[model samples]
Target: MSDQQPTGSDLSPPGESTSDTSPSRTAQLKRWAALDTTSGALLLTAATIAVVWANSPWRDSYQDLLEIEFGPAALHLHLSLADWIADGMLAIFFFVVGVELKHEFVAGTLRDFKLAGVPIVAALGGMIVPAACYVAVVGIGDPEALGGWAIPTATDIAFALAVLAIFGRGLPVALRTFLLTLAVVDDLLGITVIATFYTDTINLPALLGALVAVAVFAVLVRMARRWWLLLLPVALTAWTLMHASGVHATIAGVLLGFSVPAVAMRGERMPRTEWFDETIRPYSAAVALPVFAFAAAGVTVVGTSGIIQPVSIGIMLGLVVGKVVGVLAFTALMVRFTPLRLPDSIGLRDLLPVGMLTGVGFTVALLIAELSFEVGSDSHAAAAKAAILAGSVVSAAIAAVLLRWDARQLRDPDMNRDGIPDVDRDVIGG
Candidate 1:
């Protein structure tokens, strides 16, 4: 009956060590890195199409397409294309995120609270500071704009990782690991905010139904039975009820993901969580995320003036300025004043670019923006979208330059006669 999990490294066959140099381990890492890069490219392409379609002469068609609604209204399923992308397809993406989060907690660096505390605290500072910066700028002038404060608190991991994979070829592994951890924690916080603040009136009966379904799903998963045919309907039912219950449907994805076992049973070859992740991750990244980006990122910029509104300015500053300052400052303070220590392979200077990369608040930020403003508030929505796009681009540019500089610095002579460069050795060992 116990679902308690072993660490990730323990998922390997009982006789094999989880050495990075192992052919299987290296191949797995390469596959994941390749997938990340491909997803990033897909996201960029989708985002580009959205922006172009939004501003082109055929913009009306784009709007019409998104607004086109179908499905059974009686079942509370009638929704626009945009809504389907956000509420339906993005659930798949979040499910993968949930799997990754569970893996990290069960076996990754986050398995140790002392090692994990740095990024956890950095994520907190990252979220809080951007929110404060956003509110301070827009909330003071227009109280109604305060709702958008959460928009800047998100960090788009796919976009950020794309930048790292391109520019951080020779950088320390610890840097990428740190960024991944930070972004995951940030997503957790953003989801919490959505479930807590963005939700309106709740339907308690529907919510109770959803919770019951979730419990059932968890029990079935714990049994290690291949009941996807049955479980799929239960999952969808939970998601539908959650949607009807005034909670975001993606939360259903996370809850369902948590139910899957993270460790293999005695006769199993792989953990169910890892197996599910490997099977579903491609669809999540290559299909679900791109579609969501295409639906969500299209915002017509009227002109430069639209991009300079108080709300837009607040979003831009919060993302580009507040994120970097908050992450770096808090990380430094913790290492200096507390018992926490930075990973040996990474130094304070390295975090500057890492902090900057955290500023790319693309996907989830867009979702928050949508929730923050009324549909009729076209001006505000357009402005905020412009700010998110601009801030992310600017942050990526800065992070690229800083990472290149760091790579160059790592080229210094290696006094040790080891075949591997000192920097590489440090990164791999760490």
Candidate 2:
């Protein structure tokens, strides 16, 4: 290192900072975005921090910060910071989900009913039973709580996959793929519930306007494939109109996502659907998901009856017990009673961890919890969110244990359940 005099260009005047931060800041953001599609460690950390912050002495600041409002009033885009994150940033997340779902239907595993039926049936069972469990638990004490029956029905694909990736060493690829397909279906169902049941009064004109915007967006993405960035304004318009139409703004994301062509056109290595996912999914995972978790999971641990509350208890039961029973029972019922066949080498034993994984509903469940109650039902919302967090953690822990056991079992060929060596799977760590 050399001792050098400060150059005039390097010197800043008092009270003024030097240099453009945009480039460095933009690059740092890109680095952070790259972490999204990984193990979801960042998302979990955000939730943990939110819980800690909410219970801290400065808890009021957390709430206040979420409630702070901004945006252009001209287009009625003004909304609280939390609403923006939930409504706007989460729209991005849903868009990515839509793209994935389209790919599955068009070219991926869902293209074959025989291969996809088991997980599809399992996804249905997983969703239905949890909602049933929630209703049973919450209905007796509070019939109104039925609105949140769908809360525990969702599976946080990112969180679930992260757990599996970490602990499911030597597991069959089929199991991982099963979870992915199940999650994709679960997301579709979750989006449907939001659109069908959760929506309030409709604004026909605005909804029509949103639909028109989505059509334009669809056309542009295919025709103007080389100018994909130009679709942002149209996408924003759809999101805005959807918000104005009393529908969840995130649905706009789903529509926009669905509008994208799934197959790669001639001369392209991958479809625009994948290209869009590659571009936006990282930011969705790293930024939208964690921020949403932080905002949604900051409920007070002791609020309302908390874990003891009917809604909270119901959600926990639905996520933990309901998911396991639903997946196992419904899957068995379908395979045995119906013509739907389980894929090769996957036994009933294989589904235990799969069911538990579905119970990890950290992200979407919280969104539903928020939508379940009317604004100002703070105590109820708090209880529901607390339940989701607790349920997800418990479910994840259970799944990890089950997965590790299965992996260990696979390590010993003698412990194989079917008395046959499976050639298709990798042992744990393979």
Candidate 3:
């Protein structure tokens, strides 16, 4: 979390770790943070454009564009632009996620169990409560809609961090770190859910082929030679096989990422994994994600009837109400009952807004909604999209207000000017 060099040999590779002296690595991370903020803006713009196009008179054109397919048909690779974006481009995003997760678990804050426990528990609670809420609302009457329980369990890292950057200028650095850790854990859980629950019928031969390709990729990367050229073909082959194996092709990206070494060689200035993330992160954030949002976020609202459907209400409640309640309650329980400790700069009150901000489940929620139901066709899918958009917007708005107020409280420790910091008085019910 401090961006300091890692200490343990288990985290570092065979040679000396370059984490401390790698100026290029630090610069790349800075660039990534800056681009992450910009990408959030771009994603919102793309989603807005999709909504307008979907609701406009030329909505048919949007559907036509999404349906256009142009991949090689012989290999069963022919897919719509939307499918390519979801399955191919999104792999790049998940690859970056895998890199970050590896870094966290191996050398970052998560390497210390004490430091990792809080966010990990918070993320688990955040995921479980929302899913429970969704099922409670939609499962009894419509079991088919239960597939979308995972939709609200995600936290859009870019969007949530963008809001923090915009509204949390004077807040403690610990808050940002907490949010990052929580989001990272949230992503890991989401990935597990996708791989475990969403996978359909397995193709044993294709899956075995994918494993072979991945093994070859791992060996090639360990050689630390000009493996990119060789690995590219191997990666593609693996992806194709995974696609054919009924497992999501994006899992291939995470697998390939984990195969890369997290520590630098004796002479190298940066880890291969860091370099790869630096190079590909921009493409994923700026182009891949925005394109996916454009393709996936468009939803035609049929009327009030569609908007009030159980799926719509369930997603909304799961995101807006369930997320906030779950994150805050679980975090408080952890601090009170467990050994987890909050940073001195952060207090119980500070987490309230952070919990609410976790509700802004935009990008991944939309992706899961698409996976949950028929895309661009099912009435339920349309309602789910509408709910995701609406719920994200409402959550963002509420978090903005709460964060702004918290910022003010940080700036002025005493609201009534009667001395005795206002936060203590409020907490004590004075």
- Against the true structure, whose lDDT is highest? 2
- Per-prediction TM-score: 0.88, 0.88, 0.87
Global lDDT of each model? 0.80, 0.81, 0.79
Per-residue lDDT of candidate 1, residues 1-430 (tens digit)? 0112233454344324566543455445434533667778989899999999988988879889999999889989999988888899999988877887887788666789787888889999899999999999997766778889999999998889889878987777767888988899999889899889999889999999999999988877666355555788999989999999999899989888877777777467667777667656667777888999898888876443555788988999999999999899898889878887766467677788889999999989988898888653466888888899999999999999998898767433332223334453444222
Error of 1 at 102 (Å): 1.5
Off by over 4 Å in 2: 1-39, 302-307, 411-423, 426-429
Per-residue lDDT for 1-430 in model 2, tens only?
0001122222222223447643354444544454423537988989989999998888889989999999999878889999999999999899988988888899788989988988998999999999999999889988877788999999998898878878886787667778889899999999999999999799999999999999999888887445566798989889999999999999999999888888977555567676667557667878888899888888776343445688988999999999989999988887777766665456778799989989999999988988988544555787888889999999999999999887666333422244565555543346
How much is the lDDT of residue 252 in candidate 2? 96
Q: How many residue pairs clash per model?
A: 0, 3, 0
How much lDDT does candidate 2 score?
Answer: 0.81
- Candidate 1 lands at a TM-score of 0.88
Candidate ranking under lDDT, highest first, comes to: 2, 1, 3
Q: What is the RMSD, in Å, between candidate 3 and the native fold over all Cα? A: 6.3
